[model samples]
Target: MIPIKIPREEKLEIIANIQNHFYREMSDEIGDLAAENLLDFMLKELSPHIYNQAIKDARTTVEQKMMALEEDLYALEKPIR
Candidate 1:
């Protein structure tokens, strides 16, 4: 076993730097994991629901527009087809 003689002030500074680096890395890792989980949940649960609602809304709007256009066309006098 090698005997280590670290001065108190130097030891404190080294410890502080090591702790800061550790916490920074940990925070980054946790943030990435959280973002990935959130994206996965949104894709799995929320995206499909939102996509379906948008489709339903689009269909309703298209049908209403078609109906209105048909009525307008009927009101116009048509030339010989």
Candidate 2:
């Protein structure tokens, strides 16, 4: 599968969030590079599980919709005399 490409603006926002979280919550100061590195590591290690779960959710949704569609089609059939 092709690797996911984060938009530049969103990437910057995420990096900023990482830096802010470390500073505010952990009482640790980290630079932009450090924050960016952390974000990259998370994307590499954590994103796969999240991506898989999202795929599963989408598949379930589609399956339910398909079942509903089948039911509708069955409802539309005329009864034989």
* Number of the top-ranking candidate, with lDDT as the measure: 2
The superposed Cα distance between candidate 2 and the true structure at residue 57, in angstroms, equals 0.6
lDDT of 2 by residue, 1-81 (tens): 445689999999999999889989999999999888888888888778889999999999999999999999999999999
| Cα-based lDDT at residue 60, candidate 2 | 100
Candidate number of the best TM-score: 2
Q: Which 10 consecutive residues of model 1 have the lowest summed lDDT?
A: 28-37
Cα lDDT tens digits, model 1, 1-81, are 123445767755555555556568775333444544444554567666777799999999999999999999988967886
TM-score of each: 0.53, 0.92
Q: Residue 24 error for model 1, in Å?
A: 19
Q: Candidate 1: RMSD over Cα atoms?
A: 19.4
lDDT score, candidate 1, position 24: 82
Candidate 1, residue 19: Cα displacement in angstroms equals 22
